[model samples]
Target: MDTQPNIRSYVIDLADQLGIRYQATPEDALADIATRLAGDEVVIDEIEDLLVALKRTGAINGNEMVTLLGQYLDEKFSER
Candidate 1:
């Protein structure tokens, strides 16, 4: 049983829960989540956990994770 599709679906579902309205792929959802997280005053644990899980599952690579985190931090700190 291939779990890739299932994992992708789960990512989309999590994105929805995070308030992303339209995401065609896991990467898209991840980017949107990162953007939203950048604007948040406090990091949401569930979303952070989801990102870690995605990384563990190979949905995102280390470089991608670093890029997203960098973007989030840049935006977040620039506001301070």
Candidate 2:
């Protein structure tokens, strides 16, 4: 039995059905944000807020947004 989650297929199909074209993955998005945050201290809340703003403004699609948010939260909690 395959234990790994089969997550991406349904999302891809849903996006295709909805006619949504995604431009970047979560890692690409974090890289962009990391570039933007260069020369500054890393503040988890601030980064989260920035990502939330981007999502609110429709800058990133839902799947990538959640992925980015999950990565951010994982990093934030793991550091402690």
Candidate 3:
């Protein structure tokens, strides 16, 4: 399925706020974050972007957000 661009943009834009935290390039950062992806890891920035975006948005709390994202990515990879 084609993912949403706004979500993806939100991710990278969010990553920018993370600055040093996201030391790698956007693509690399996504790849690393998405390594939960099996066998052939994907470079899907959309997913990574979402992670960063969620963190960037002050709408949520920190520990809860991490827990939520960790569960999410695990589920996504588990599906593969």
Candidate 4:
């Protein structure tokens, strides 16, 4: 069975636990979280490393990586 949706849900839940307010789109919420967590110099590599660590620790699943990280990247790039 396809588990992408489930992974995405889990990732969203994880985001909430991380204090990300879902007051807008997922991408917007991610951007807000990034700003609050990393400030202005939001390094892409550091974000990737953090996500990887989260997955390794089972805080997030492998499948949700693309869903969560990709949305953040999309939001960041759109501003460029």
Best prediction by lDDT: 4
Preferred candidate (TM-score higher): 1 or 2: 2
Give TM-scores for every candidate, taking all chains together and pairing residue i with residue i: 0.39, 0.42, 0.39, 0.43
lDDT of 4 by residue, 1-80 (tens): 85454433555556557754323346745886889787675544545555655666667686777676887576557769
| Error of model 4, residue 27, in angstroms | 30
Provide the lowest-lDDT 10-residue window in model 2. 5-14
Candidate 1 residues 1-80, lDDT tens each?
Answer: 75454433455575556554431468857876888888954444444455565566666788876665565555456769
Model 3, position 21, has a per-residue lDDT of 38
Candidate 2: lDDT over CA atoms?
A: 0.58
Q: Ten residues in a row with the worst lDDT in model 4?
A: 19-28
For model 3, residues 1-80, the per-residue Cα lDDT tens digits are 75654433544555556551323457865666667664565554455545655555554468856765676566567769
lDDT of 4 at 60: 68
State the C-alpha lDDT per candidate: 0.57, 0.58, 0.55, 0.60
Residues 5-64, candidate 2, lDDT per residue (tens digit)?
Answer: 333443344445555553456875787688777865554454555555456557666787
What RMSD value applies to candidate 2? 9.1
| lDDT of model 4, residue 14 | 69
